[model samples]
Target: MTITTREDEERLRLLESVILNTTDGVLIAENDHNQDSKIVFVNEAFIKMSGYNKEEIIGLSPIGFFAPDASSDELAKLKDAIDKCEPCNIVVKTSKKNGTKYWVNVSVAPVSDGSGGFKHWVYIQRDVNNRRRHLQALEEQNKKLKEIAWIQSHVVRAPLARIMGLVDLLSEHHDSEELSNNQIIEAIASSANELDNIIRKIVQNTENVQNQSSL
Candidate 1:
């Protein structure tokens, strides 16, 4: 039999409360040969995050358990880490109980059994869907900016230069051996139209960068 003081009980309650209420999902998995890294314990936050009950979560393999949509390469990498008994941090798309998918960052570390042997793996899962969306938005914006730059530097330059040269030629001579007056004006109009189209494309791309990030 064991004895516990009032202070010990209070401390235990505090620990349990903190673990249950924390926003980050926390779970413990069995690490022995018999268990094959199946989950043994999960906190309330994990249950809420996974959209599954505590009973359903327990006894399930932590790897690919919540993230069925996770790629094989990601699962293999995590399996390799588990095989080596090393800590691993991976981000993958996971499905909730409702079948909707979200991004999560799962970090797992080996927990010692106090006998100099590995006993369990403690996983800390953080929902990172917002972060992933923000990153993708930033990437989209960067791509648009690069395209705009290219249009300004290369595509826009050609038409503007053509327009400027045509105007200069019109100013110098209404009719020339190289071209007629109407031909020069037609060339100028064509260059202007091309420049207008390029500008519209750049504007469309910029608008896309702004609108597509709503996802």
Candidate 2:
């Protein structure tokens, strides 16, 4: 039997340390012929990210971490990529050992031996919950802004048009005195009230959206 020399042991320790200390979580899954892929190795970052000990996670299927309600379509894509021996990148929500869920960007690639045979599948996972939430909030804010713009262009225009017409009537009837001053004044007051109400509604909706975003 060949014994590992001191130099060889030192190299191994360095490699282990490099993998363990990295921020990105790494998992190595053996390509099993008799069954589903089995997780053979996981680094310390993975343990921390998943809140699971190394002993409890090794030999388990990688899919066990997937959220219960995770999209089946995404699962199908992952399977298809594996079947074709192609790399796959997907973002999925996964549960930790403590049962708390978080978003992760998982990248899977096939590792090959020197003889061109598949050896293992390497998965690199990164937490992306904060980025996802930020994007979602931006989308919602955009939608709200669009709603406000629509109200300004369409809803607010009706009352404004009414005011313009009443003023035009007042101007045209000034010399002829066909329309009474009081009648013109009443029309303008009604249109102004309607416009004020529309503005108030827009303000309320904007405040509501802002509150939601803050939370």
Candidate 3:
């Protein structure tokens, strides 16, 4: 039988106090290796995160915490790690008691008993829904920027080439046709220069935006 001493009890209480007040959600469960695993304890942070009381979740399998319809690869990977008694990290979506769904990063490790077997699992969880959304927004912006760049390269080419050819024709036939008035030739060249400057500004602005997102 194991003996309980005042010194051991004091140390245990100190550890419990730290877990109880931690910012990240902490959960300890019996390592039944699957949906059968039973939750043994949860910290205050976990209670707040899930909107569930200790009495409501304890002694129940964690299947209730995960959404039944969620069949994502991350969920499957977490299950596989548990079956192998290994440590794993994954971001998964779960529903609170009020049915409000959110994303969290779960880091779990198997705790071994002295007899070469895993007796329990320790899980640390933190919310990451906002971070995921920000990344998705950045991806969408990058996609649109790429489409704009492609249009500038292909669609604008024919018109710009035509402007260059017209300028060249003016230079060669300056004394040929009555249409080659000095004032008229100068106006056309000035207009072509303005269009070139506008296109350059658009390309430069696109590069600036792309660079900011990467940083």
Candidate 4:
């Protein structure tokens, strides 16, 4: 019995240590109407992410770290979900101690006692600023590529097609006896060469754009 009790205590201590040292920020808050939501627990990751110490955060409300322009409706919805013991995901901007705002993806769920009574709300947050920026850049690049395709299809190709057609007609009648036939043949050759050069340049430019986009 003594050995079993000691083993159980060691296991509990290890579990607590794991919870407190995880990389993802973890916060446990109690729902209290008379006072602000009390932060009962915060892990080391939460302290590092928020630049707050355990003593600074323990009795404070988590919402105080939210941006000043945060939506009340969203906060209300999150509170309602927590009250009903539902898990929910919300994206919001959070401010650090220096007032620098960053985007976070937060998931909240109810923590309950063994008897099914509400104990506290547990929130897990991850920083998503880099991912958001990459997504936005991809969107902008797609828009630019669409614009370039429109220009190539409409503006560049139409004129090239007309020049090629006129050159073909001149070449077909090159056996004419007229003295100006030689001049016409020369002009046709020049137009055909110029059109080929233009097409090649356009294709090369488009391929370069595509390669850059992939990178």
Clashes of each: 0, 0, 0, 0
> Residue-wise lDDT of candidate 3 within 34-153, one digit each (tens)?
446888999999999989999998887654466463457877887889878899988888888898888888898889898998888888988888898788878877787887778677
Deviating ranges (above 4 Å) for candidate 3: 1-7, 32-35, 67-69, 155-158, 174-215
Residues 100-165 of candidate 2 have per-residue lDDT tens digits of: 888999998989876988768888999998999999999999999999999999999999998998
Give all TM-scores, in the order shown.
0.81, 0.83, 0.73, 0.73
Candidate 1: where is the Cα deviation over 4 Å? 1-6, 64-67, 168-175, 193-201, 204-208, 211-215
Q: What C-alpha lDDT, on a 0 to 100 scale, does residue 130 get in candidate 4?
A: 83
* Number of the top TM-score candidate: 2
TM-score result, candidate 3? 0.73
Better of 2 and 3 by TM-score: 2
- Local accuracy of candidate 4 as per-residue lDDT tens digits, 1-215: 69999999999999888777788899989978764467888998988997878999898876665536356866776767765779888787778777778778888887777797876778898888788877877897787678777867876666567666656667677455552556665766766776677678767777876776677
Candidate 2 accuracy as lDDT: 0.86
Residue 39, candidate 4: how far off, in angstroms?
Answer: 1.0
Put the candidates in lDDT order, highest first: 2, 1, 3, 4
Better of 1 and 4 by TM-score: 1
- Model 2 quality (TM-score): 0.83
